[model samples]
Target: MTRESEALSLRVRRVLHAPRAVVFRALIDPDELARWWGPEGFTIPGVERDLRPGGSFRITMRPPDGEAFHLVGEYRLVEPPERLSYTFRWEEPDPEDRETVVDLALRDLPGVGCELHLEQGSFATPSRLALHEEGWSQSLDKLDRLLTAEGRA
Candidate 1:
């Protein structure tokens, strides 16, 4: 089997309604991330970020039905308004699941807009990959709304 088929990765790009710095903070800062860090209808009751290489973060994502889930990761590389890369893994992981890398690149497009490129994973199953894609998409949507409301658009 091809390498991709063996361990697939998901990639997506989106333009946000904010400047690069704003978008960058939304991804790194605990409060900013809590504002727009999960799927629709999800709330974050707990968030911690150490914000440096080798530093770790943990976020509690509580869904509408309660039973919060935790997302934990460590910073691999962090560059303001430019690039950030980290290792991501759910707190309660699947038996076959492995830690995955998430790389984000932000490009400042003039007129107070930024482009975000997100690449994540090498999942053992398609369902796992799909789950992340859907979650990330929704989170990005919220981020866009948050930034727009901040008048940064």
Candidate 2:
């Protein structure tokens, strides 16, 4: 994993041992997304998605020891096996929370697999940026494990 952070934005890069198409599918497919979409110990109880530009998605996330919460977003761009972008906002946001844009770019690695570049921006504060950084790091770790376990890695 490689991470780059600015005061109000973040970038994370990970090399996945799975093909680009598979990783791209995992991002937009509700079933596959629910299986590995959150930080460690977090589970997804519900996922509703339209999977197209201008469409929307709502994901219910259950923490290890708290009430479930939701994250809602609208798709901005969705190009299969290559790129995706969306607007992300918490349904019930913290005072510091603000809607942000998340962009994902997937590059094929030939014989190896694929590289995923994730960028999210314009946080209200550095603390908010830090929080998202941790969440995304753990979530990507979980995704890697999922793909490996399924023998796609």
Candidate 3:
């Protein structure tokens, strides 16, 4: 994995040990997403998605110990097995929270697997960026493990 950061944005790259199609499906399939969508110890109790441009999704996240919260988003672009872009915002935002855009690109690596590039941006502050960085880091780690356990690795 590799990461690049700016004051209000972040980029994360990961090489998943799975085919591009497999990884891409996991991203858009609500059932697959619920299996590995959050940071360590976080569980997704509910996931609702309409997978298409202009479609929206809402996910309920239950932390290790706390009331569940929600994050909602609307799809801006959805290109299967390649790209997806969406607007992301917390249902109940912090003082520094603001809606942001998330873009994902999946590239196939012949004879190997796939590479995922994730970019999210225009945060209200560096601290918010850091928080998302950590979350994505852990979430991606979970994704890797899931693919591996499923024998896609």
The lDDT for every candidate, in the order shown, is 0.90, 0.93, 0.92
- Give TM-scores for every candidate, taking all chains together and pairing residue i with residue i: 0.93, 0.95, 0.95
State the lDDT of candidate 1 residue by residue for 21-87, as single tens digits: 9889888888888889889999999899898999999999999897988889999999997999999
Model 3 regions more than 4 Å off: 1-6
State the TM-score for model 2.
0.95
Clashes of 1: 0
- Per-residue lDDT of model 3, residues 4-110, tens digit only: 33557888999998999999999989889999988999999999999999999999999999999999999999999899999999999999999999999999989
Tens-digit lDDT string for candidate 2 (11-99): 89999989999999999999999999988999999999998999999999999999999999999999998999999999999999989
Tell me the lDDT of candidate 3. 0.92
Comparing 1 and 2 on TM-score, the stronger one: 2
**Residue pairs in candidate 3 whose N, alpha carbon or C atoms collide under 3 angstroms:** none
**C-alpha positional error of residue 97 in candidate 1 after TM-score superposition, expressed in Å:** 2.8
> What TM-score does model 1 achieve against the real structure?
0.93
